[model samples]
Each structure stands twice: as structure tokens, then as C-alpha cells.
Target: MKILLTGISGQVGWELQRSLMSLGNVIYMGRNQLDLSQPDTITTTIRDIKPDLIVNPAAYTAVDKAESEIDLAMAINGVAPGIIAEEAKRLNAAIIHYSTDYVFDGNQNTPYRESDLTNPQNVYGKTKLVGEEAISSIGVNHIIFRTSWVYGLRGKNFLLTMQKLAREREEIKVVDDQIGSPTWSRMIAEITAQIVAKFQQNPSDFFSNKGGIYNLSPSGKTSWYGFAKAIFNDDFSNNERKLQRLIPITTQEYPTPASRPAFSLLDNQKLSDTFGLKIPEWDQALKLVLDS
Candidate 1:
């Protein structure tokens, strides 16, 4: 089967290129080749490629910047995916889109389920929710994966940021009040490939019975401070650059333009039960990333 993969430059997209390759032919495109900001370009690309599946791992991910650049954010995060979904419908192809945990307002103390109501507190989350609604309205075969706290070896993510800071600075401050699972992009790609293989083996079983949103994250949770401490302990043990002071602070102390969910952990029971898949612990996944 021929698959069209977008956001080839992103961390998840980069890993997905390798995982999806075993299944069939994958035509990868980055923003330069297929910019999400251009609706006509997305429609034309999908029409021209005529892929059996379209894996969209791209979005306007500037969470804090979205507050200032609402139009650009909405165009890429909200409007573009809608056009892709519409085109996929016309081509009778399946679409796989990635969302975020920010869709929730962070009020719930327990892990979030797929059925939980979404009340985004920030502009970035609102636009992503809009994208989800658009895809749902298209009435096509699509699977939306909501993930949280994604990190990887490459790309600008929390893990890399912490690593760089540990090397350059003597001390660092991280938010301890907010908690979520740290997902490895590699795991996301692997799970996505597994889902695609399942569908390929039994297309009717998936299409006629199951095809909807599912939370794709690691099994455990941690705060930003904990995550950073773990990284520092693992990456630099005896070096002079080892983190000397990791000051834990609240979200309000280190404020950004976007308001993040206080507790963004997602329950994976639905995804595991539906796909017969098991995710590793967040720390194990982090180790794998660091090792790689």
C-alpha cells in the first residue's frame, strides 16, 4: 500500500518514516514540500498522491506563541487538516491525525479518558480541538491519536531543552505542580505502525467496527521537575555540567502565554483494549531515547 506521510521534519514524523517503511511504500513530505498553511496545496497533494493512507504528524505546535499568532496557528492546526480530511474522503483513503492533551482544561484530578469532555483553556488547544471537530465532520475513515508531553532524540522538545540547559547552566527551574506522561516519539510511531498493520490484515474489522480517537501515551506520569531530574541524573553523572540545583516551582511562577493543563495524564485502557497493544513506562521509554 502507498502511504502519504506529512511533517517529515518533526520528531514523530522522522521516526514514523522508519516504522511505516516496513508496511509499504511511504511518500514523505515536509513543510517545504507540502505546507499546511496552504489549503489548496494540501488538497492538491492528497489528490495527486492518491495514497491508501495519510499519516499527518504535523501541526502548529508553538503552544505559547499561538496566543500571539492565532491566525497562523488556526490555519495550520485547524483549517489545513480539515482540507486534508475532505480530500482523503474523496480519495476513499484513511487519515491518521495526532492531537494533544491540552484539549482538556486540566480540572480533572484523574486520568483523562477518550469520552471525557474537552474544555481547552488556551488558544493552541482550542485550535486543535477545532481540527478534531473538522475531521469528525468530514465523515471519513480516520483515527485521531491524542498524546501528551512528546519528547525525542531530535527536534525541539522538553528533553533536549533540559539537556542543553544542564550543559550550559548551573541551575534550572521546572514546574512541579503540572503533571503528565512523557511520550517518546519513537513509541508513537511504533504504535501507529502496529495499528496500520492491524487494519491492513483486517480492514473490515477496523472500519466496520472500530475507527475513532484514542490516547497514545506512555503508561506513567511525572511533573516537569521530575522529568528533568531524571534526565540530568541519567545523562550527566560525573561531569561538571551535571545539574547542581533543580529548583521546583509552580506553573504560575514560570508563566507562559498559554495555560497548560495542571494534570494532563491520559488513560490508555481504551487504546490497549481496542488494539491489543501495551505501552512501556515513561522512564523506560526515556531511557531508550537517551540511549539512541
Candidate 2:
């Protein structure tokens, strides 16, 4: 199979290169090659490649910065997805897109399901939801894996931020109220590869009854503070950081322009039922990333 992948420089995309190598002839494209902001560019590139599958791990993920870059965010996160879906439909190809848990407001006490109502509280979430809608509306064979708290070895994510802060400052203050699964990008890529391989074996069976939005977060959830502590304790040997203390603070104390969901835990039962894949808990996955 010929595969076209976007966002080759992102955390998940970086790992996807390794995970998807054995699947087929993989073509990797960064923004310079196939800029999502330009619909014409995306159309030209995808048509030229004519891939059997399109895997989109690229997204405008700046939560707070998206508030100021609404047009760019919408173009990439909202409009670009529809463009890709349209092209994929023409080529009789399938797509696997990654979305986020921010689509819902933090009102539910339990984990969110695929059918949960989406009321994005921030611009980033709203735009991502638009992407999901665009792909689904196209009626193409697709799987939208909505994950949360994604981080990896190389990326401007919470893990790297906390690791840097731990080394630079003696005390680190993190928000204690906001909660998520803290998924590793490598895990996401690996699971995606597995699903793709499975789909290749039975395309009709997979897309007929199983293609849809499925929560792909780690099994367990934790506050930002707890997540940071896990990183220090599990990721580091001998606690070898300059961090002396970790202060748990409220979201109000460290306000940002983008509003965050207080609890954005996603339920992964549908994923298990469909793909027979159940991601491990946050702590377990963190160890795998750190060890690698």
C-alpha cells in the first residue's frame, strides 16, 4: 500500500515514521511540502501522490496561541481536513485522523464516550472539532482517534516543559485541577500502526462497522501536578534534577488565554471493541517513553 503522512516533524509524526515503516511505501510531508493552510497546495500534493491511505497527525495545537491565530488555526485544523477528505474520497482511499479531548466541556463526572456532546471551551478545541466533523461528513472510510495530554521526547509538550523546568528551577508550580490521560506520542503511533495493519487485512469489514470516532487516551487520568511528579519520579534516575519542590496550584493562579477543560478524560471502550486495542494507564505509558 502507498501511504501519505502529514506533519513529519510533530511528536506523533516523528514516531509514526518508525512505526509505519514496515507497512508500505510511506511518503512523509512537512508543512513546506504540503501546507495545510493552503487548500490548493494540499489538493495538488495529495492528487500527485495518490496514496491508498492518508494519515493526518498534523494539527495547530497551540492552545493559548490559537486565540490570536483563529484564521490560521481554522484553515489547518478545520478547513484542511475537509479538503483532504474530499481528495481521499475521490481516490477511494481511507484516512486516520488524530483529534483531541478538548472537544468537550469539563462537566461530565465520568469519562467521555464517542457519542458525547462536544462543547469546546477554547478556540483550539473548536477548530479540532471542526476537523472531525469535516472528515465524518465526507462519508469516507475514516477513523478519528481523539486523544488527550499528548507528549513525547521531542516536542513543545507538557513533558518536555516540565522536564526543562525541573532542571532549571528549584520549585515547579503546576495546575492541580486540570486532569487528563497524559498519553505518549509513541504509544499513539504504535496503536495507529496496528489499526492500519489490521485494516489492510480486512478493509471492508473494518470500515463497514468500525470506522468512527474512538477515544484513544491512556486508561487512567491525573492532574498536571501528579503528572509532573510521575515524570520526575519515574522518568529520572536518582531524582537527578534541580527541582527541590513541586507546588500544586489552581488554574486561576496560572491563568492562560485559552480556557482548559477541568477534566477531559476519554473512555477507550469503543476502541477495544473495534480494534482490540486498550492503551495502558498514563503512568505505565510514561515509563515506556522515558525508558526509550
Candidate 3:
């Protein structure tokens, strides 16, 4: 099988390079090769590749910056996905897209199910939701995996930010009120590969039955403060720590351009039931990443 993977420089995409090779001949594209913001470029590139499977991990992920760069964000995160889906439909190829937990407002206290109503609180979430809707509306063979609090060794995520601040500052203040799972990008890639393997086994059956949105995240959840503590606690690195204290603060104390959901924990029951995959806990996944 010939597979086209986007966002080679991203955390998930970087890891996907390693995981997806076993399934097929993977043609990976970084931002320079296939810019999602350019509609004609996206069309031309995908048409040239003519892949049987298109896995899109590329997205405009700057939450705060998206507030100012509305058009760029919408183009990459919103409009680009629809364009990709259209091309995939033309080729009769399957798509695996990544989405976020921010699609829903944090009104409910319980973990969010796949069937829950979405009410994005910020521009980033709104754009991601648009992407998800576009993929679904295209009526293509697709799986929209809604993940949360994604971090890996290579990306500028919360885990790396906390590690950097730990070295530079004595005290680190993190928001404790906002809660979600801290998923390792590698795990996301591996799970995606497994899904693709299943699709490979019986493409038509899988597409006809299991082609929709599924919450793909670790089993447990935590606040930013808790995640920081966990990172420091599992300090497997050789570098010396300069952090004296890790302080917990509320969301109001630390203001940002984007309005974050207070709780965005996604329920993985649907994904588990459908895929027969046992997901690791958030802390366990964090340990595996830190150890690596």
C-alpha cells in the first residue's frame, strides 16, 4: 500500500514515520513540501502522490497566536482539511485526521464521550472543529481521532516547556483548574498504525462500519500542575534540575489570549470497544516518554 503522511516535522508526524513504515511505502511531507495553507499546492501534491491512504497530522496548532492570525489558522486548520478530504474522495483513498478535545466547552464535569455536543470556547478549538466537520461532511472513509494535551520529546508542548522552565526558574506556576489527559505523540502514532493495519485487513468493511470520530487519548486525566509534578517526579534525564518549587495556580491568575476549557478529558470507551486496543494511563505514557 502507498501511504501519504503530512506534518513530518510535528510530534505525532515524526513518530508516525517510525510506526507507519511497517504497513506500507510511506511518503512523508514536511511543511516545505506540502503547505496546507496553499490550496492549489495541497491539491497538486496529493494528486501527484495518488496515495491509497492519507494520514493528516498537520494543523495550525498555535492556540494563542491563532486569535490574531485568523485567516491563516482557518486556512490551515479549517479550509485545508476539507480540500484534503475532497482530494481523498476523488482518489477513493482513506483519511486519518487528528483533532483536539477543545471542540467541546467544559460545562459538564464528566469525561466527554464521542456523542457529546461540541461548543468550542476559543478560535483554535473553533477551527479544529471546522476541520473535523469538513472531513465528516466529505463522506470519505475516515477516522477523526480527538486527542488532548499531546506532548512528545521533539515538540514545543507542555512537557518540554515545563522541563525548560524547571532548568531556568526556581518556581514554576501552572494552571491547576484546567484538566485533560497528557497523551504521548508516539502512542498516538502507534495506535494510528494499528488502525491502519486493521483497515488493510479489510478496507471496505472497516470503512463501512467504523468510519467516524473517536476519542483517542490515554486512560487518565490531570491538571497542568499535576502534569508538571509528574514530569519532575519522573526525572530520568541526565540534566540537573534547578526547580525549587512547582506552584499550582487557577486559570484566572494566568491569563492567555485563548479561553481554555476547564475540563476536556475525552472518554476512550468507543475507541477501545471498536479497536480492541487497551490504552495506557496518562502517567504511564508520560513515564515511557521520559524514560525514552
Candidate 4:
């Protein structure tokens, strides 16, 4: 099978290169090759490749910057998926796209479900939701895996930011109000490959029954401060860094251009029940990321 994978330079996309190798010939494309910002180029590139399955991990992922760049964000995150979905439908191919937990307003006391009413609080979230709607409305075999608090060894993420800050600064202040599971990007890609393998093995029944959205995140939730503490304490379990302090602060104290969800945790029971897959706990996953 031929698979067209976008966003190969990104955190999830970078790991997908290794995880998806066994599945098929992955035609990976980074920004220079498959720019989601350019709609016509997106269609042209997908058509040119004519992949059996299109896996889009690309998006306008700058949460704060998106507040000022609405049009660009929408073009990439909102409009691109529909265009790709239409092309996929034309070729009778399947699509697997990644989404964010920010699609919800994040006010719910419990973990957000796939069927929850979406009320995005920021432009980034709003655009991502638009992408989800676009693909769903296009009537193609698709799987929207909405994940949260994604971090990895590579890329600009909370884990890397903390590692940098801890070394340079003596004290680190993290927002404690916002809460979500810190899912490793590698796990997301591997799980997706497993899903794709299943579909390739049984296309008719999988799409006929299981073609829709699913929450793909780690098992538990934690505040930014909690995650930072884990990073420091775990990473420095043997070695040394700043060897310093962590101050937990409220969201109001640290304001950003884009408003984030207070609690963006997602329930992954649906994904687990459907795929018989489960990510390790937040702390355990962090240890794994740090160790290997």
C-alpha cells in the first residue's frame, strides 16, 4: 500500500516515519513539498502522489500566533482537510488525520468524550475543529484522532521547553490551571500505524463500522507545573540540571495571545475499547521518553 504522510518534520510526523515503515511505502512530505497553507498546492500534490491512504499530521499548530493569523490558520487547519478529503473521495482512498483536545472549551469537570459538544476557546482550536468537520462532511473513510498535551524529544513542545528552562533558569514558573494528559508523540504514531494495519487487513468492516473520531491520549491528566516537576525530577534522577525550584501559578497570572482550556483532558475509553490499545500513564510515559 502507498501512504502519503504530511508534516514529516513535526513531532508526530517525525516519529511516524519510523513507526509507519512496516506498513507501506510512506511518501513523507514536509512544508517545502506539501504546504497546507497553499490549498491548490495541497490538492495538486495529493493528486500527483495518488496515495492509497492519506495520513495528515500537518496543521497550523502555533496556538498563540494563530490569534493574529486567522486566515493562514484556517487555510491550513480548517480548509486543507476538506480539500484533501474530497481528493481522497475522488480516488476512493482513506484518510487518517490528527486533531487536538483544544477543540473543546475545556470547562467540563470530567474528561471530554468524542460525542461532546465542541466549543473551542481559541482560534487554533476553532480551526482544528473546522478541519475535523470538513473531513467528516466530505464522506470519506477517515479517522480523527484527537490528542492532548503532546510532547516529544524533538520539536518545540512543553517537554523541550522545560528541559531548556530548567538548565538556564534557577526557578521555573508554569501555569497550573490548565490540565491535560502529556501524551508522547511516538505512541500516537505507533497506535495510528496499528490502526492502519488493521484497516488494510480488513477494509470493508473497519470503514463500514469504525470510521469516525476517537480520543487518543495518555491515561491521566496533570497541570503544567506537575508535568514540569516530573520532567525535572525524572530527567535529573541521576544527572544534574539547575537543581532548582518549581512555582505553580494560575492561568490569569500568565496570559497568552490565545486563551487555553482550563481542563482539556480527553476520555480514551472509546479508543481503548475499539482498538484494544492503551497508552502508559503520564509519569510512566515521561520516564520512557526520558530514558529512551
List model 1 lDDT by residue over 31-89, tens digit each.
Answer: 99999999889988888889989999999999999999999999998998899999988
Number of backbone clashes in candidate 2: 0
Model 2 RMSD in angstroms: 1.5
Worst 10 residues of 1 by lDDT: 233-242
- The TM-score, computed over Cα atoms with residue i paired to residue i, of candidate 1 is 0.97
- Top-lDDT structure, candidate number: 3
TM-score for candidate 2: 0.97
Clashing pairs in 1: none
lDDT of the structure predicted as candidate 2? 0.92
Candidate 3 has its poorest 10 consecutive residues by lDDT at 234-243
- How high is each candidate's TM-score? 0.97, 0.97, 0.98, 0.97
Estimate, for each residue in 82-175, the C-alpha lDDT of model 2 and write its tens digit: 9999999999999999999999999998999999999999999999999999999999889999999999999799999998887778888899
Q: Write the per-residue lDDT of candidate 4 for residues 7-52, one digit (tens) a residue.
A: 9999999999998989999998999998998889988888899998
* lDDT (Cα, tens digit) per residue for candidate 3, span 1-292: 9999999999999999999999999999999999999999999999999999999999999999999999999999999999999999999998999999999999889999999999999999999999999999999889999999999998789999988888887788999999999999999999999999999999877888999999999998899999998999945353676788788999999999999999999999999999899999999999888888
Off by over 4 Å in 4: 234-240
After TM-score superposition, what is the CA distance of residue 173 in candidate 3 from its true location, in Å? 0.5
Off by over 4 Å in 2: 234-240
